[model samples]
Target: MLPALALAVAVTVTAPPAAHARTGPAPSAAKASKTAKFPPGFLWGVATSGFQGEGSFPDSNWTRYVKRKATGISDPYEKSVDFLHRYPGDIKLARNLGANVFRTSIEWARIEPRPGVRDPKAIAYYDDLIRRIRAAGMRPMITLDHWVYPGWVADQGAWDNPKTQADWLRNARFIVDRYKHQGVIWITFNEASAYMYKELTMRPMDLGQLAAMRTAIVKTHRAAYDMIHKIDPGAPVSTNVAYGTALNGIFDAALFNEVTDKIDFIGIDYYYGANAENLTAGYALTGEFWKIDPEPEGLYYVLKSYQRRLPKLPVYVVENGMSTDNGKPRPDGYTRSDHLRDHIYWIQRAMADGVKMIGYNYWSLTDNYEWGSYRPRFGLYTVDALTDPSLARRPTDAVATYRSIIANRGVPSGYVPVRRPGWCSVEDPVATCFGTTPTPPAAYRIPAR
Candidate 1:
C-alpha cells in the first residue's frame, strides 16, 4: 500500500463528518428482499477510441499531433495496437473477465474523410466490429466522436469554424443509422470539454479558439442526439461528457446539460479531479496521467456533483483508471490492483449511499495511444507500443481481480483495506469536506508532463 500525502481546504460550513453505510435490507431479510445486486443490476465494462486503438488508415487531429511531433510519437502512425485486427481477441479478452458491457468509438476521420464521399470500406470494418461484440455476448457502447476529425475538415478551420458541426453530424448520422440494431448504448462525443483543450492547446488553446470549440461540441451533441433517435427509436442515445474542473465547468456544464432531457443514460467519464493546484498548471483533467488524488472518496463526490445538476438520470462512471509506465510499483509499493480495489470500493460505497451510479468502465482494454505518447499506460491488458511488432496484448493482475468481482457480482465479504485513505472523508455525502485541511506546499503534486 502507498502512504497518502495529505492535503486540505477550508469549508464554508463547519459540519459533522459522514460514514459509508452498507446497502440492502438486513442480511436475513436482505437476501430475500434485496432489491438490487451488489453491482445491483448495474453494468461493468471498459472504453476505447477508434484512433487510439483502431490504428492507422488516415490522418486527423491526432495524427497531426504525432506527425508535427507536438509530443514524442516515434511510430510511423502504423497500425499501433492493430485492434482493427485484434478486436475479436480483445472482445474475447473482455468476455473472459465477465464484463457485460464495452464502449468503443466510431472514428469520423476514417469513415468520412472526403466531402459527400462515404467510405464503404471503413463502414464495413465497424460493421464487423459491432457484430463481433454481440457474438461475445456483451453489450456494445459506441462513442460517435472520440476527438479525431478528418484531415480535410481540420484544414477547414476545425472547431474554430462552426462549419464543423455539419460535417460532424454527417458522420454521426451515418454511424447511428448503420449500427442501431446492436441494441447498443450511444455516446455522441467522447469528452467535449477536454477536447476543447486538446483541439486548442495540443494545437494550443487560446481563449477565443477554446470558446468556439466548446460551443461547437454542444451544438454537435444536440444534432447527433436528434439524428440518432430519428434513426432508431429503441436506441438509447446520449453523449459521454468527460468531467473537467470542478466536475465539468461548474457553471458551463449547461453546455452539455441542456440536452440532458434528450439523453438516455448519462456516461460521465471521470479521470481525476482538479484541486486548485492542478488548474494552475493548465492541463485539462482528461487522462489519468497524474494521481491527483488516489482516494476513493473523490469518486463519490464527483458522481453526486453531476447528479445534483442532472438528477432523474442514472449516471455511469464511463471511464476511470490510473496510468502507469511499465506498471511500475507506486510510491509506497501500491500496485495497479490496489488502485482498482480502492477506487471500486468507493464506487460501491457511492452505490450504498444512493448515487444511482449505474456502471463502471475502465479507461481501456488495451494500452494503445495516449494522445502523442505511449508512455501513459491505462489498460488492464498492457501493450508495449515500443519494441513489439506483434502488438501482443498481455493481461495484468488487475484482470483477475476484476474478473472475480464481476463473476461473484461483488468484492468478497469481509474484505478490508491495508490502510484507510484520508480522502475517505469526501465519500460522506453530507460533509463533502473539500479542501478542509491545510495542504503542505512541499506536497504539491508534480503533475504529468
Candidate 2:
C-alpha cells in the first residue's frame, strides 16, 4: 500500500502549458477503418443520488449547510428534481436509453430519519423504486450514503463519534436485507474522500479529529462490506473514488488506500483533467465547478493507473460526465455527444490494453441539486427544478447518441471522435508527452455484445 499524503485543496493541479501547444495528437498518416467493441457483459448505465434528486427537503447535514445564510456561496434549497415523486418516469427514461444498470442512493437521512426511527414510508418509496428499475429490465446499483447524514447524526459529533458507525451499520443491515434479492450492486459510500474533504474544510475540525473521522469511515465501509456479503454473498460491493486530475495519488491516500481490501470491484468517478499548458484547474480554487473543462480522455489514465495498482479487481466507472452551466452549450463549444463519444473511445482503448473494465455509468440521469447550486448541470436529461414548476425532463442531444452507442455495443469502428485528445494531458504526463498516441485497430472490429 502507498503511504498517505497530506490533504490539500482537492484541486492540487500542476502548471499548464500554453493552449496552442496542446491541440491533441498529430494525425497519423494511416488511419484504422474498423471500430472496436466493448467486451461482452460490459454494463452501461446512468447514476443519481437520493439527496441530490429526491426533493421536499429532508433534515440533514446538507440541508443545514444550505440554510446557513452566512455562507454567501450557498444556493436556496428549493425542492430538488423531485425524483422522490417521479422516479417511475425517470426509470423508464433510463430503460429507453438502453441502459442495463440504474444507480441511485438510499438517502440515509430520509430512510432512517430521527435516529433509531426508520421511516416506513421512506422504505416503501425505495421498495417501489427497486421494483420499477427491475421491471424496466435494469439492475439497481444502490449507494448506502452519499455525503448526507441525519441532522440528528450531526448532533452526535458526526463521524467523530464512534457510536455513529454503529447507528449507520444498523441502518445498512436493514437496507441490504431488503434489497439484496433484487440483483443490486452495492456502493458502501459515494465518493468517500470527497465526503471527508467537505467535512474537514466546510466545518471546523482539528487534525486529530480529521484522522479519527477517516478511521471511522474505513471501519464503517469494512463492516458494511462484511454485512452485505453475509446477507447476499454474490453481490458486488465498493466505495467510489473521485479521481483527482493529475493528483489522484494524493487524493487516494486520504481514504481509498485504507479500505482497498474490502472492495469487490474498483469504482471510479472521474470528471476533470488538466493539460500541461492549460492549468485551468486554478478556477476550481474559487469553488466554481462550472469553470472546469471536460477532459474525456482523462478517464483512460484513471482506469490504467488503477489497473496497474489493483490487478485483481474489475474496474467500474461509477460516474463520468460533463457539467455545463445551466444546461447551456460550453463556451469552448464541446457538446455532450462529443464528450461521450471521446470518452467511450478511450474506454475501449484501455480495455484493449488488458484492463478488466466491467461497467460505465453516466454521472446522472437528470440534473439535481449539485452540492449547493443548480448551475453545474451533468445530465443527459436536463431538469430545471428551480425555475420550472413542472420539473420536466428535457432530453439533451446526448440522449440519442447514448442510445445509439448502447445499441451498437459501442461507437462504430472507424468513427472518429469529434473532440480530439488534449495536448499535453497531465492525466499521464509521461505518456502524453513522449509516447505514441494509441490508434484504433484497422482490421479488428469488436463484435456487438
Candidate 3:
C-alpha cells in the first residue's frame, strides 16, 4: 500500500497540468446587503490538532506511516511548532487576537497510552490547557479524535476489530465524564471521510477492511453523542464533515447521513472550492501543495446548501483558511487577511439569508505540520518549525484583520468582497448557475434545483 501510494504521489508531480480554469459568463455581484450581520452569540475561534501542532508524538499510526520507507522524500517531523511545551504562550497569542474560542484535540494516544490504563500526567496536561483557554476569556472546543489513536489500539487491527470500538467508547466515555462541566462544544471525529481515505490509501486495507473501519467510526460517533448529552444535556455534539466541492453530496450519503439525527449541530470544514473554470483544487488531489486558488464566496454556497439540507440544525465553520506555499505570498497576490474577510462576508451573507449559521473557526492559529509537510502554511501566525530554532510565532497580515472582525462581530456593512463570486461555482452549481437571492424565511431550499 505504501509503495503504491508513493508511486501515485510521484505521478502527480510528473503528470501534465490539469485544466484548472474555464470560461463562463461574466461574474455576478453577490446579492447580500452591505450591512448584513451574523446572528447573536456566534462563535469566533481558531483551530489546531495535536499531531499537527504538538511536538511530542506518541507511537501511533501516523508516526509509523512517516517512518515507513515508501513515504519517499518528505520532511522529517521535528518538534512540530512545539505546541506541547509552548501552548501557554500560543494560547496567549490567540487570546490577544480577540478570539473567543480556541479549538484543540485531546489526543487519545497521550491520554490513554495503554488499554484500560489512564495517563494521569497526560490528563493533567489537558486539565491545565482547558483552564488556560477559559482563563484567557475563550471557550474550549475539544475534538475527541483527530486521526490519531493509541498505538495499542493500532496493534489490535485498528477499527476492523470489535475491541477497537469497545476501547474507543471506553476512552470517549471517560472524556465525557471528565470534561462535561467545561461548557464546551464537542467534536466526535474530525473529517471522517478524509480519515477513511488516508487510512485505506496508506495502510494495506481491502474493501472489507475499509468498510469495517468506517462502520466502527459511525457507531462510535453515535454512541459518543449520546454519552456526551447524558453528562451535559445542553452540550452540542457533532463530527465535522470536510465539505468537498462537487463531492459533498456523495460524502454526505456515504458517511454523514447515518449520524445526522445523532448530531446536535452540523460542523463543516471547507477550504478549497472548484468551479467549471477553476480546477486548481485538482492540485490538492495530486499532492501539488502550491497550486490552490482561493474562492471565498464558495463558502457561502456550502453553508446555504447544508442549511437547506439540515434546516433544523445550526451550522458551524469548524475549520476554514487559506494556505500559501511555505509561508510566502501567493503569486496571485491574495493575502491571508483578504481571504479571511472575504470568507466572513459570505458567512454573513448566508446568515442574512436565514441559514442558521452559528460559528466560524480559522483553520489554525499558527502554522504547524500540515499532515506530511510544513510547506502549506495556513495560519494567522506563521511558524517555521523546520528551520527556525526559536520557533517564534510571527503575526501575519490576517492577525489585525481577524482582531477587528471579532471585535466588530463581522466585517463592516459596506465591505465588498476582495474577489467577486466565481462563475458557475461547483461548490453549489445549481445555486450559482441560477441565482442566490435570500430564501424566504419559511423556505431554505437551493433555488431552481
Q: Compare the candidates by lDDT and give the number of the best one.
A: 2
Per-model lDDT: 0.66, 0.78, 0.78
Candidate 1: deviation at residue 113, Å? 2.4
In candidate 2, stretches whose alpha carbon ends up further than 4 angstroms from where it belongs are 1-35, 70-73, 436-449
- Reference-based TM-score of each model: 0.82, 0.89, 0.89
Off by over 4 Å in 3: 1-35, 69-73, 434-449
Q: How many Å off is the CA of 371 in candidate 3?
A: 1.0
Question: Native-vs-model 1 lDDT?
Answer: 0.66
lDDT of 3 at 73: 20
441: Cα error in model 1, Å: 23
How would you order the candidates by lDDT, starting with the best?
Answer: 2, 3, 1
Q: Model 2, 1-449: lDDT tens per residue?
A: 11113344322232221122232343221255323488667799999999898888678888888887423236676789989899999999999999999999998898877978889899899999999999999999999999889999999999889999999999999899998777899998888767776676555456667677777887899999999999988999999998877556656755677777989999999877787545666555455666776666677777777877789999999998888888888776778887798788878767766678889999889998888778889899999877899999999999999999898888876666655455566776666776565544442221000
**Tens digits of per-residue lDDT for model 3, 1-449:** 34234323322322231222322332233443633676567788999999999977878878777777223227778699999999999999999988888999999898988878888988898889999999998889999999888888889889989888888888888887888787788998898867776776666577677667767887888888888898878988998998776555545543577788998888999887877657777666655556777777788767777777688999999999988889888776778998899888888877876778778899889998877788889989999988899999999999999999988889987666666555578865555566543324233111111
Q: What lDDT score goes with residue 110 in model 3? A: 89
> What TM-score would you give candidate 2 relative to the actual structure?
0.89
| Residue lDDT tens for model 1, 1-449 | 00000000111112222233322221111121112236556688977888888876586878888888763444556676898888889999998888889899888888887877878888888888889888888889998777788888888888887778887887777778788777788887776655554654567646666656666777777777778888877777776776544333432342455567777777776655533222321232334364444444356566655666566888888888877755565665555676676567656655665678778888889888887667678889998777688888888888998887777766554444332334213233234333333323333232211
